[model samples]
Target: MVIVGIEPTEQNEVQNHYNLFKLVRAPNLAPNQVAFRIPPNVNKLDIRDYLTHIYQIKVVDVRTMNYAAKRPVRKRDGAMRGKYVSKYKKAIVTLCDNFKYPPIPDKQSLDEYEDRAEITRMNFRRLRGWKPRPQRINMRKKERYEKFNDY
Candidate 1:
């Protein structure tokens, strides 16, 4: 997609990828309700205002949350660590009851997706062979190593 005259630049871009909205599924959310990951500084009211003014959607309610960053934990011993994560904000915006979300693509798009998946499956089968691999013999039961040989 491109605009007639306007060209996007790295610094000139208003916000980073983090500021974009991604559709998500939530068990608790009702129909036509959508979820978006927003900036930590943005509030619920700001979200409502932005949706109404920019997208022209009538926002019924906006719920925002700021999730805490995960603390680092030891992977195996004190020498290694894992699960480094950053804190982020999420907004659940409920559109007006009258609004309807777009319908899922018909048979054509779904057929395309199925074709792509089939191609990927065929590629894997070609490289690995179509037959199922033989089960691995249990090495732990009959231990072969007399000592802890790192090699």
Candidate 2:
């Protein structure tokens, strides 16, 4: 996987849309903040560079954790059902404490954050052509017969 850092504009959009944020393991921020997944085998220095260039933020520190791919489960047919999980790394980027974001004046309470999360969940609710249910073959045939049987 590639170690590309998410852009600041994109990050702001995501934050406005998802009400979630990322943070590093620095001494300033909370320890269990948001985490970003990086591609496997990415170099530490490259990740540092990405954080600075793409996010346009001064990274005070960076750290990563790697996990091994998990094996697939056995199927009833004596064959493996699914492939092994992909291996990836998580990067924790600690930004300079002076970093500041535009305050969300519209969101005055925690409930507002929850509402924003729900909106993010429904981001693609009005997509143009995203049909989840396909037309059944027999149903199509029945409709054709109905349309012509008027004679």
Q: Best candidate per lDDT, number? A: 1
Error of 1 at 80 (Å): 3.5
How do the residues 5-40 of candidate 2 rate in per-residue lDDT, one tens digit apiece? 333645432222322223323345453333566567
Worst 10 residues of 2 by lDDT: 12-21
Task: Compute the lDDT of residue 10 as modeled in candidate 2.
Answer: 55
After superposition, the stretches of candidate 1 with alpha carbons farther than 4 Å from their true spots are: 1-18, 98-151
User: In terms of TM-score, how similar is model 2 to the real structure?
Assistant: 0.43
Model 2 regions lying over 4 Å from their true place = 1-34, 75-83, 98-151
Reference-based TM-score of each model: 0.49, 0.43
lDDT (CA) for every model shown? 0.59, 0.55
Go through the candidates in order and give the clash count of each: 0, 0
Model 2 clashing residue pairs (backbone):
none
